[model samples]
Target chain A: MTTQPNLAMRNWNQRVGRTALYLVLILACVAYLVPLVVMVMTSLKTAGEVQPGTIFMWPENPSFDAWIKAWSQACIGLDCRGIRVGFWNSVMIWVPSLILSILAGAILGFALSRWQTRHAGLILGLVLFGAFIPLQVVIYPLIKMAANLGLYNSFAGIVVVHIIFGLPVLTLIFSNFYVGIPVELINAARVDGAGFFRIFFGILLPMSRNILIVALVLQGTGIWNDYIVGVSFGTPDIYPMTVKLQTLVGSQFGEKEYNVNMAATLLTSLPPLLLYLVSGRYFVRGITSGAVKG
Target chain B: MATIEIRNLTKQFGAVQVLKGIDLAIDDRDFTVLLGPSGCGKSTLLNIIAGLEHQTAGQIMVDGTDISPLPPDKRRLAMVFQSYALYPTMTVRKNIDFGLRVAGLPRAEIKERVRVTAELLQITDLLDRTPARLSGGQRQRVAIGRALARRASVYLFDEPLSNLDAKLRNDMRIEIRQLHEDLGATAVYVTHDQVEAMTLATRIALMNAGRIEQYAEPQDIYDRPETLFAASFIGSPKMNLIPGTIRLADGVPVFDTGSDRISLAHYPFRLAPEDGMPATLGVRPEDVAPDAQGIVARHRLNEPHGADTLAWFTYGETNLSARLEPVAARALGAQATLGFNLHKLSLFDPKTERRL
Candidate 1:
């Protein structure tokens, strides 16, 4: 008889505890989502409806005029075209940089982990340490070096900068990922008459799909959204979307168009958002598998 | 098929010497097992022969040609790893054809070879499936099939069945032996299991601490172990070793155990026994049986093992085990008299640990 009452009380307590946990989780999620909700709502509202109190409310008469204006007609200084002007430029800078950087990183990581030289440990340590150093600290010297090579404020200059900054993290991801692969597999390939490149491309590279997606998400977002590197190194004609977006929104003397600005902000973040949505599962698995093993 | 000759092979990993001047000659079409406990450099020796690892100082001759300068692929050898090491991303068919494809064989030849190899391994239905979808035994067959497709002169197995369950291991062992007989390929297999070594090898090179303790046929190694380690390592439940001294009583050799003296008059010694020399006597458990005219010992424990029961008894300070029929062991009470089979007894020098 006592056991029956005790079991009922225990069940009640568990239900209350679970409900409280769910309530707190919901509150946290709503708190984090508030700003994003406000941004989208403001972007959809007309200019007159975009006042302080109406920031979080759904627009009564929503229009995509701001999205269109932001894409092609909003003015930033003398240029009235908008964020669309630098979209192709951002793609050009990001795609080549992403490919070259990932390739270089994978090769470096493979060599460091598998065909280790005497200095591999020291070099890996140095690379990992370099990941912590602020990119701002190296920017000035990089500018001088870029100018000496006659690539300052040019497309090549920005691509090279992205690769350089991206190398440390990319190499760390790939090296840790490759370390989990058995050494016998590599030996088996060698006995199968595979040379270094053949084994790497045929055997290792195929198995690295998950980690590669993780790297692409990281490097793609970082390089795509990069503003400082673009501003410091890109010329006016080759301004990346981020630099162009900054100039579009950073007006000094005109009445601010918050709707247009919010629209542009969402547009610039769309690529990374779509990437995460597409490859989110692989991203989580990759990080845990590579990082947890090490 | 090729005869492998390893002359004075030595390997050192920095401060630790892994292979200490190992010299072994494997005959053509032989199933040679490198048998040892872990860290005995058996795998390292196999890797050196396959050219996957470089020996510190050695000359490896395959069919009278020194293959020291060649790489693993050039050595014409294929190996099955302990882990199976199948490519997880590849289908079984692709895994089998990878070596030949990389060697740039014609497409039809590669296909025919893979088909025949898969059929040989009885894995034709599994060729389209990835390794992750296969069972452990099937994965091992695919790994072996990959090696078979290579058609190398020598096949190396690095404890390929260590990961399987007991029943699967037994089935695979018989299959591997049958395959060896059918192909007549020279194979070097490494394993720590004494049963695997005994069942699979035409010759067994028993290694200890980077040295070959004994190298001979499996039965020869079992019957005439040259050292104490060999005798102890080869048998299950282990050979019972009794430490004592050889003393001359009436000009006849006698093993004096301080508490009991056993006559060694009929025992054959590798060398003539000296009086008052410390020696260890070794005898298999099955050789000891119940007899009225034998030494008396107190029965401590009895372990029933289906076909036979192991009876433990104390003789002096050492507890000795004997294999007996279950009924015979069960009939015994707190005490039992055990007799040693003199013809099968082994005597070892205590100092050198060699058979005397």
Candidate 2:
């Protein structure tokens, strides 16, 4: 009889705690959504309606004129063309950079994990050290090196820069993942007449679905959103979407067109947003298995 | 099938010597088990034989040819790992045919091998499924099938059934023994489980502290362990080692535990017994029984295992156990007399801890 009342009291307390938890979660969701909502509303509104008092208000005259303007007619420095040029360049740059970096990282990670040789630890430590150093610290030297190699202000320059920066983290993640796999598996493969590349492609690569997705998402978003590397290494013609967006927002003349700026900003952010939405589940799984395992 | 020889195999890991000067000659078509507890370097010795691990100093000879310099694959050996080590991404069919394909065998030959292997393991229906989809026993069968499919010169098993439940381990143990006989292949198996070692090994190399303690047939090892380590390590209930001394009562030598005197006339000692020499009396639980002419013991505990009762008793300050029938166990009251079968007991020199 005493336990019954105690159980009831515990149930009531649990209910109160659950309600408070949901309340806090809902508030956080609203706080996160408010900026995106405001951007959407401002992008839809005309120049006259976009003011401080009208920030929370819906667009009374909603249209795609700002989107079309941002996509085509917005001026980015000397080029009066839209961000589409940067969009295509970003796509071309991202595809090759992501592929090359992930491939190099996976091979290096597999080799380090399976085969122990002299300086393996030192090499891993150096690569991880590369990941920790601020990018600004090495950007100047890389720019000079790119110039010396005739890659400066070229299409390949930005791609190569992204790959170099992407490798350290990508290699670390991949190596950690591969290290978690049982040594017996590698030994078994070796006994089965599989050499280095054969075991990697046939055995290890096929099993790297989740970790590959994680690497893709990481390097994809990284390369796509990159601004400083693109501006530093790439010419105006081959500038990425993020750099082009910055040019459009900053180069606006006379009265600012907030709608077009907001539209371009949202457009610039869409690919990574879509990537997260698509691979978010796998990304969580990969991080837990690879990074958090230690 | 061919004979394999390991001569002066030694492995050093940093400061610790894992395998210190190991030598063994395995016969053709023999199931040789490297049996020991963990850290005994049985697995390392197996790896050295397979060429997976490079020995610090050794030569592995198969059919009198030194294969020590060859890599694992070129050594013509197949290994079934404890974890199964099945490629999780590949189907069972691909997993079995992996080696043959790597060897550049004809398409038809690879297919035939896969079919034969899958059929042998009774996993033909599971050929299309990946290892992730298979149960543990099925995976183990596939691992065995992969090794069997290769038809290599030597087969190695590294505690393959230690991952399974007790019932499944027994079933797999029988299957492995059957397969060895069926194929007549030269095999080396490593396991810490004494039951697996005893049941599967045609010739058992019992190891301790990086050295082989005893190498003989399973029954011989059990009946006549050369060292106290072998005697205690092999039995489940554990051989009881009673500290005693050898003294001459009249002319015949007798082992005198502090409280009880046991005759050593029937003991097959390698050395002549000396008076007042320190010794250990090794007695297995099953060899002890209730007898009127035995030493008096105070019954301490009774463990009624279904097959037999293991009644634990205290003789003076030493604990002794007797494996008896349940009825005989119940008849053992607070105080009972216990006798050890004379012929079955082992007499170890206390100083050397070896059979005397």
B-chain TM-scores per prediction: 0.97, 0.98
Model 2, B113: alpha-carbon shift in Å?
Answer: 1.5
- Expressed as tens digits, the lDDT of each residue in A165-185 for candidate 2 is 888888888889998888899
Backbone collisions counted per model: 0, 1
| Candidate 1 lDDT score at position B66 | 97
The lDDT per prediction is 0.90, 0.90
What tens-digit string does per-residue lDDT give for candidate 1 at A2-119? 9999999999999999999999999999998989888898889888888665576789899988989999999877888888888888998989999999988998888788763569
Kindly report which residue pairs in candidate 1 clash with one another: none
**Candidate with the greatest DockQ versus the true structure:** 2
All candidates: DockQ: 0.59, 0.64
The 10 consecutive residues of candidate 1 chain B with the worst lDDT sum are B265-274
Which regions of candidate 2 deviate over 4 angstroms?
A: A1-35, A45-61, A252-257, B240-277, B283-345
Model 2: per-residue lDDT, tens digit, B1-356?
Answer: 79999898899999999999998999999999999989999999998887788899988889999999988868779999999999888999999999989889999999999998888889999999999999999999999999999998699999999899999999999999999999999999999999999999999999988999999999888988889999889887888789889999997999888888998789876767789999888899999999988789999989999989999998877888899999999888899988889999888876787888
